[model samples]
Target: MATKRFAPTPTPSLLSSFTTRPCCLNTSLRALLPATRPFSSTPTPQNWLTPKRGESSKSRKGKPHVATGGSVRGTTLVWGDYGLRLRSHDRRISAHQLKVADETIRKRLRGTKYRLYHRVNANIGVYTSGNDQRMGKGKGSFDYWACRVPVSRILFELKGDVHEQVVRDAMRLAGNKLPGLYEFVRKGDPPVMGITKVGLVGNSEEFLRRPRVPVEAPSLPHTAQRIPGTTPV
Candidate 1:
């Protein structure tokens, strides 16, 4: 005697699709509709990396003074001879970081005749977070403020009869916090030589985007044989 076998039938799924319109279709189509979302999670301002409403920006095409080369302004006969000129060799300084650096230098120059003139401006605003949420939305909310510092752009200049030593100390103190490479050139000093090690040697050699000598900024405050060593304090 032989036994008879039967085939099993397939069950239906909760979701269904049809080529033509049907009176009834399975699954929700709400997701298919377009939704409004921000391009980034961070909240963006009307304008970024530039001056805000009622904000003043000191614009100088070439230099502060044609003859003085922007290194000296206001009090030339007094503290003009001694002042530190900062330029961005590499990297960009954020608005917050710039503030910290400015404050640090100001504190160091306290009770002194040296005055600080800001060259770079912070106009960038950055947003953050919103990654955890579902996709297809927008940029995250604004997280913090920032600014871009271009290469070879003057950052700060100390004006007045500031002693070279004190200015050196102030530069070191300020440079410690600011990002990128900076040289403490005097008012009339020639542009510092860049220590860039670029060309590739072998397969082991690597390429650099910025290519600065050493990432670390100069540590020495000032040389021994410098004028305006220290104030009578």
Candidate 2:
């Protein structure tokens, strides 16, 4: 019966300052590490465009139709001097696309004295499920956030001491990142309701209220008209 005895290894100069006990080593390590501030579980506010907490996150994909009454809200610049207005059909724009467009404008107008305004909020949450999964249980988890923009609705506006050309160029670059056509609009411009612009002197209510007169079809000449149930000789 023989017993083997191993030599105790020498501790490095780094560990010479603290005892080799497991408890002492742990305490020593904690003391050597830098103190970290506790981070809040709540997410930092992204922007005003992001929906607030406790608000309804899931929203139905509603049509971007303007009511017949014609309210001119978001049709013209409210705070900014210049704006980018949608000129095409209504559609839902995702938050990512909007962010890219925003970045594009900001990048183009960097160092300029301009305050950009966002007319829309990405509060609507879109949900989707796996393509192979069978439908029936429930709507899948949220996929992305989006905002509905109707025809002639302003998306972004700029206000500040910036030049008109610079503002126009920035907006033009931004428009390329987003879907649908967009036009530059200025302050005091006529408000647009749907595809029609409400003139300064025109009443939106009256304009929408006007009835359409249907055009009558032109009558065909005798030589061109076909006889009913008659064979041509």
Candidate 3:
């Protein structure tokens, strides 16, 4: 008997056999892929942190040399008695710059009770005779006389430009906020009292000045005279 044999046809290529569903991917997985569009590599604004170079520390110093409590870069309040000890550096600071520093401090320390004080001393120049120069001597000098206020009264020292705006906005939203709080207003031609101690010490001309007013004054009796007793019908 003779047997018939049949040859099998060759199979299609593996690539041809495989199927794809439009290259679909999950939403989260799509996020992992690189952005197709060009991106701007700009950094976002940062709050509660010191400004970068070429940015003003509001004219006091390029950087705040003295930060008391917590790490200067952290969000938590650095709790401690912060102070500024100005050394004579031929440069003098401008009035505007002092305003900047005051505002900066108020903004950074908002919601936290911290005291601030300012003091001025004679800068004994590197090789000069007396340490008699006050801070804020130069129009743009880095050296300046300033102090931190007490933690309790810190909120009252806010400046008009930035700090006042913030307070005004807050008040508009909440209405008559921070009641009983007092603000220190700068006065006079240069808008600063010459050097005076936290209580009164250094030269006045070159030092940062605070407003002075009698905190407690007695009220006098009404000067108007009373009418004689009269009966009404």
Candidate 4:
């Protein structure tokens, strides 16, 4: 009677001939990289300047016009003591040109403890007319790309202890490199009174505040675009 000891028979499913491979975490497929597109040499000028008329409020609503130029909204940069600024009295500034100015300022401010900051953001897209295009065809078919600079706006701001002459020289080079005229302004100036302070550190306060300079000074574009994103040394 061997205590009725006996091995129970395996279940039908377990005894089946079907075979399955072991599960493995390392055997999972490799993750894929995100897709990216190359920037075109000539970017098409989409009608980003304005919205097309006749779209329903459902489609056009909640979509604000993209800013081409102006002080960065909701920001009060360059308000710190002794920081210098470049101000535009009229017209909007362009991005390609702004980058040129940024590079020029960096070149001047290099080898210093100072850090340069752009008070106004230029991610806003703008367009230009194609060469020899006829007038009056919806802003000339969006020829080239640029940024806008609003009147009474601060373009670039320099932070930290810096020489006033150095800032003036830097702004002069920057202004001359841009499309339109600009005045170097300093901290604590009355808001946009057409009064720009230049010489603050050394010499006469009045002389430093407003020096004799030409108006409508133009900047020639480089044959090849200057490299953007130069860091301070």
Candidate 5:
């Protein structure tokens, strides 16, 4: 019999040679695969990286943080802001009270020799008996209003018992006289002439009282006496 000459059986390593050449095998397999095969099993893109609570993307990055109680000159109050920028020393007054006081002063001093200077924080500074035209025109020479007023007077008239003593003490410490208008600000008395060197000629009591007037009744004689013997009943 002729000797059997079968092609030598390929070695196991030779039979699996494609495994060692992954690049070549992958290219060939990909070309043969379907184009629409699902590329990945992963889910669609998500917006999970969006901003979370208390994290603002547009936050101010450059401005310095201003702490409370910080004082900056020329800063003004922001209306309707809930008093966030209010100063501790600022005095508060009602709008009605201010209007009433202003009208009262202007009416009383009409054609008078004095002027009113309304200062900040609702305080009124009166130039007592000052020349009306020259009141605020020239430098200080005549009687001018000062911040110091007897705490007693302010409390009695403006603030009542609550602020009276406090104002008085403050005035005393400052060595300043109380506002001249305090004399007419008595609780029971009607408004009186305020402090004025020009009108200081008369005594205070006399000035306060109203001038008296005399009246005469009509003189009529009894008609019976004149009528001859008309019964004197």
Candidate 6:
């Protein structure tokens, strides 16, 4: 002898009174929402980022400090009227990050006459191993391309007939997409050496020469010499 099972009665949702048709509610919501450009589903162009064929797939973590040991070169605006310069510590900026920032600037400046300059390229390849993997298998596999950007280095430069305010706004928005602190710079601004600006308010010659000076050994007697297994005196 088995008991009979009964079907449960359905209940209407509270929202059913206000929105009789689900499609109509969806349409109304869409109408109230702002339209936005869809994110690109296509792969990034290899020409814009990927390292050239035959290039090393992995690289050392190189410093942004130039051979001169100062952040002089690549820190000033050269071709563009305005630029975005890093103001904090150096870091490896990935190709994807760069593309996002570039797209942001271009989107904001759409319909404007302007030329954007990429001061740095994502030529360095970064590699990583799988999680929970044992060591000694190798340096892992190629993960992404990146460029080492030193502090005070200009990442992007823009020049055109666009108004200063508009360009500034565009750059500000773009900077937010990038890592680290950034400062808006203009043409003719003083070049930066490290965190300090060269030739600003002080003797230009002295400021320029400070980082260029080579280290010299102190004058010593003729008897003074490098001891065995030690550095030179």
Which candidate comes out best when scored by TM-score?
2
Better of 1 and 4 by TM-score: 1
Poorly placed runs, candidate 3 (over 4 Å):
1-80, 120-233
Between candidates 5 and 6, which one is better according to lDDT?
A: 6
lDDT of 6 at 146: 88
lDDT of 6 by residue, 1-233 (tens): 99999989766444553586898777766765679867888986556577657464458767765435543788888899999999878688899999999999999999999999988889888888899879888988778888888788899999999999999999999889888999999999988877778887784646556655588989877778556798765
The lDDT, on a scale of 0 to 1, for candidate 3 is 0.34
Error in Å for residue 95 of model 4: 1.1
Residue by residue across 1-233, what tens digits does model 2's lDDT show? 89999999977554676787899788778776779967799987457456766345456778777656666777888898999999888678999999999999999888888888888878777888898878795777888878888788889989998899988998999999999988999999988766777764565657666777799999999997879998867
The reply for model 1, stretches above 4 Å from the true place, is 1-50, 54-90, 191-233
- How do all models score by TM-score? 0.46, 0.67, 0.19, 0.44, 0.16, 0.66
| Model 3 per-residue lDDT tens digits across residues 69-139 | 21212111123222222222223333333445546655655775444433221121111223576665544
Over 50-165, each residue of candidate 1 has an lDDT whose tens digit, in order, gives 45653243221221212212222221122334433344433545677887888898898889876666666665456555657777565556655565554444567777766788
Q: What's the lDDT for residue 149 in model 1?
A: 50
Residue range 139-204, candidate 4, lDDT tens digits = 432332344545445667787667888888888888888766566666655443233222334433
Better of 5 and 6 by TM-score: 6
Model 5, TM vs. native = 0.16
Give the deviation of candidate 2 from the true structure as CA RMSD. 11.5
Candidate 3 at 11: error in angstroms? 99
User: lDDT score, residue 63, model 5?
Assistant: 24
Please report the TM-score between candidate 4 and the true structure: 0.44
